[model samples]
Target: MTASYVAIVLLGAFAGGFVNGLAGFGTGLVALGIWLHVIDPLYGAPLVAICSVAGQLQTLPAIWHAVNIRRLLPMLVGGVLGIPVGILLLGHMAPDLFRLSLGLFLIAFAIFMMFNRSLPAMRWGSKKTEGMVGFCGGILGGLAGLSGPLPTIWVTLKRWEKDERRSVFQMFNLTILACVAISHLAIDGITVAFSQLVLIALPGTFVGAFAGIRLYRRLNDHRYNLLVLIMLAISGITLVVSEIG
Candidate 1:
C-alpha cells in the first residue's frame, strides 16, 4: 500500500475504535467508509471484522463486570444461526437498495428517539425479542459487515442502563465480528496487504479504545442516550452516502 493509504487506514482505525469504545459499537460504520477509499470492500470488510474485534477487546476489561450472560446467550445463538443465510444472500441481493432502506429507517428512528420524551420502554424486551434482533443483526453483518445497528437500536429503545448497554454491545459485536472474520478468512486466505493493514490499525485501535472507555465512564444515562441517538443518526447518513456514492 502507498503511504497515503496507510495513513488513511490508521486514521480510520483510530476514529472507528474511538466510536466503538465510546458506544460499545459502530467501528465499521465509521471506519469501513474511510477504509473503502483505500481498499476494495471485499478486503475492507474482513479488515473491519478483525480490527473491530480488537477494539472491542480493548474495552472488555472495563465492561466485563456489566455483561449479562443470560441476556447475551439468545442473541449469540440467533446471530450464529442467521449468518449462513446472510452469506448465501450476499451476492444475489441488491445491497444498495437494502442499505438505503435501512439507512432511512435508522435515520427516522433516531430522530424519534431524539425528540420524543414520552416513548415507552420495551417492558417485554425478552430473550425472544433480543434473539430476533440478533438474527437481523447477523444477517446484516454477514451481508454488509454491519451488525451493530439492530442490537444498538433495540437496547436503546429498551432504555437499558449505560452498563447494560455496553455489556450487550461489546459482547454482541465481538461475537458477530469474529464469526464474519473467520468466515471470510476461510474463504479467502489472508493476504499480505490485509495482515499489514491489521498491524497498522492496531495502535490506533488501542489508543482510541482507551480514550473511549474513559469518556464512557463519565457519561450519565441521559448523556449516553443522547450519544447513542446522535451516533445512530450519523451512522444512518454514512450508510446512505456509502450506498449512493
Candidate 2:
C-alpha cells in the first residue's frame, strides 16, 4: 500500500476504536468513512469487521460481568435469522433512504430522551418479540452493514445501567459483524492484502481503545447517559449528511 493509504487506514482505526471503546458501537461509522477513501469497500468492509471485533475484544474484560445473557440471547437469535434477508436486500434497496430514515428516528429518540426523564419501559410478550427487534437490526446489518442502531435504541429505551447497556452494544455488534464478515469471506476468499491491512491497523485500534476505556471509567451514570445520547445524535446527523452529500 502507498503511504497515504497506510495513513488513512490507521487514522480510521484509531478513531473507530476510540469511539467503540467509549460508546461500545459506531466503529464502522468512523472507520469505514476513512477506509473507503483508499480501498474498495469490498475489501475495506471486511477490514472494518476485523477491526471492530478487535476493538470489542479489548473492552470485553471490563464489562463481562454486566452482560445480560437472558436478554441478549433473543436478539442474537433474531439477528442471525435476519441476516440472510438483509444480505438479499443489500443491492435491491435504496440504501440512502433507509439510512436517512433510521438516522431521523435515532435523532428523534434522542430528542425525546432529552425531554422525558424516564423513558417508558419496553415490554414484550416473549423473548421472541425482543428477538424480532434483533431480526430487524440484523436485516439492516446485512443491508447496509449497520446492525447496531436498532438494538442500541432498544437497549437505551429499556433504561439499563450504563455498563449493562454497553455489554449489549459490544457483544451484539461483535456477533453481527462476525456473521457479516464470514459471509463476505465465503463469497470472496481472503487475500494477503486483507491480512496486511488488518495487521497495520491493529496498533491504532488498541491504543485508541485503551484511551477510551480510561475515559469511560471516569464518567458517572448521568454523564454516561448524556454521552450516549450525544453520540447517537452525532451518528444520526452524520448518517443524514453522508447520504445527502
Q: Which candidate has the top score in lDDT?
A: 1
TM-score of each: 0.94, 0.92
User: Model 2 over residues 1-245: C-alpha lDDT tens digits?
Assistant: 78988999899999999988888887887888888888777787788888888989998888999988887899998998889999888778888898899888888888888788675666543787778889998998888788888888877777778898889877888999999888878888878888788888999899888888889988877788888888888888888898888
Tell me the tens digit of each residue's lDDT in model 1 across 56-139. Answer: 988898878888788799998888887887888988989889989989998999999889947889787677978988898888
- Give the C-alpha miss distance for residue 190 in model 2, angstroms: 1.3
The runs of at least 3 residues in candidate 1 whose Cα sits more than 4 Å from the true structure, single-residue gaps closed, are none
Output the TM-score of candidate 1: 0.94
Poorest 10 consecutive residues by lDDT, candidate 1: 117-126
- RMSD values for the candidates in order, in angstroms, are 1.6, 1.8
- Position 112, candidate 2: lDDT: 84
Kindly report the root-mean-square deviation of model 1 from the true structure over all alpha carbons.
1.6
Shift in Å, residue 238, candidate 1? 1.5
Residue 152's lDDT within candidate 1 is 88
